[model samples]
Target: MHFAQRIQALEKNVFADMDRAKSQAISKGKKIIDLSLGSSDLPADPEAIATISASLEDPSTYGYLLHHGTLNFRETVGQWYSNRFGVEVDPQREVLTLIGSQEGTAHLPLALLDPGDFALLLDPGYPSHAGGVYLAGGQIYPMPLLAENDFLPVFEDIPSQVLGQAKLMVLSYPHNPTTATASLSFFQEAVNFCRNHGLVLVHDFPYVDIVFEGMTQPPSILQADTQKSLSIEFFTLSKSYNMGGFRIGYAIGNAEIIQALRQVKAVVDFNQYQGILNGAIAALTGEQTTVKKTLARFQSRRDAFIKALNNIGWQVTPPQATMYVWAKLPQTWENKSVEFSTELVAATGVAVSPGAGFGKQGEGYVRFALVHDPHVLELAVEKIAQFLATRT
Candidate 1:
């Protein structure tokens, strides 16, 4: 049997490899403390769940949901954006519902890139960004996000030739894996760079509300591109509202870009269940107390995990936002992230993501998702300490 070359590009999935190692550990009677993925281990707001439950009672929601059926959700998203960021959003022309932010990030490249075009992506970005470019037969120009630069890409470093062919620039704040947040001024610089290069700026902003205390709330791209010129941002209810399983999110940005993405969406599949949209609407419109509680809980977990890691002699900076801790590998594990992660999990049953899985620059680090309770996270770190001791 034969498969498309595009599928071939996806064969080196880090998560998949980690899953196999986890299974092997489990088979060996190791109790796994998995933290390889960022899926939130929290519950959706009761109001949102109640709204969906109510919608299930209505038979009309069982039918196929087209783009128009998502209007109310889009309007809710637009209003949510306006209320949160002080930026006006037009639901009719500038908002498009997505399965999740991943869907938008992965599919937008198809709408923007032709074969051999270039996409400027963060070196250690969420995998879907590169997958989307590969699926579209587009070239990827990885913009290295260095620690010295606060994990943000340097727009000036992109070569002239790659910039000429680049049609899209993908960014994320309170970014996945890295857990680094970007400021509005940084976003302003990105908007200007994209505008100058005639590139569509795509910001995957799933961790919008997971910001820890004392950190300035990450800005929406639209806040920088106030006129809705060259930017589109994807927001998800997954991280903020603990609605990961709901597959609900939206894109808000330039009208033309939104429409182009909508066209791609149309060809791929109809929208998700209308009930899910209703739940999303409820999540956005209801009292945001759930959001606050979620933030507080994650912050507690972050503090506990960071303290535990540091106690184990694995010093790592406390992330300002997001439910993740991106830690550099110890000297012994440097440049061997995949081997380190695999061996660590196999030996200790504490699974984590190898930084190399994210990209080349990610080679000497590992990402830990704060998906467990403080006690569980500390236990995982204790196991890690024992494992590291063996190497010494």
Candidate 2:
């Protein structure tokens, strides 16, 4: 039996490779300290959990949830967006419930792209962004995010030929892997570029509340495209609200794009369980104290972990947002991110994501997720120090 050609691009996953390595290390009797994935270790807010628990006893929520059934959740999302970003949204037309933001990101391409059309993607971006394009049978033109330019793509560098065939461009910030935050000004420029080029702009905004150092909340793409022209943004409860396991999120933007994605979703699957959306509503409207506490906890871990790395002579710039520390590899391991990560995990039982797994530009770097407690993060660095000493 033969698999479809689309499966070809999905076959070489770096995370899967790392997972096997981690399993081998555990089999060798090493206790693993996993910093490879960004799934938060924090618990969901009690309010959200209680809301879901209550729904389980309500027989009304046990039926299939169609698009119309999600109206209340959509309205809550609209209110949350308005209060947070000061941008008005029509929940009836511009908002769509998603299983998670990843579902929207992965499925939107089917609605936007034709086979062989191009998508302008950030190199070293989240893996699912490229996977979506691949699944849609589209081409990807990676816009390199260089350190010299603050890890934001330079629009002027996108070749005109590539731009001609490109139908969509995806951006995320605070970005994954690199943990780079984009400014409102940068988003304004991106909106202008997309407007001029007739390309749809998609912003994956999973880390909107993960900032540090008293910085303002990251601006939404709608903040720049006030008219919702040629733009859509995806948001998830996973990162900000510690609802990763709940798999609830939403998409908001141009009514047409929202409808298009909704059509694609109709063919894919119905909405997530109504109970989950009810719990998500509780999360969005409930006290934000859990959000604040989660941020403070991650900031503490970031400081402790970065300090430990510097103490071990592996200096790295602390990230401004997201739960990751994107560190350039030491000189000897610069070009061997995958090898370094595999060997380090095998040797020290500390797992981290290899940068190259994200994209070619991600080579020569590694990403450490600050998902563990500060004490565990410090211990992981201590083991890493020993590994580096032996390698050097």
Question: 1-392, model 1: which lDDT tens digit per residue?
Answer: 88888888999998899999999999999999999988888888899999999999999999999988888888888888888999998999999999998999999999999999999999898999999999999999999988999999999999999999999999998887888889899999999998998999999999889898888888999989999989999988998899999898889999999999999999998989999999888888898888999999999999999999999889999999989999999999889999999999999999999999999989999999999989999999999999999987
Over the stretch 258-278, how does candidate 2's per-residue lDDT look in tens digits?
999999999999988889999
Q: Global lDDT for candidate 2?
A: 0.94
Residue 373 in model 1: lDDT: 89
Off by over 4 Å in 1: none
Q: Whole-model Cα lDDT per candidate?
A: 0.92, 0.94
Q: In terms of TM-score, how similar is model 1 to the real structure? A: 0.99
Best by lDDT: 2
What is the TM-score of each predicted model, taking all chains together? 0.99, 0.99
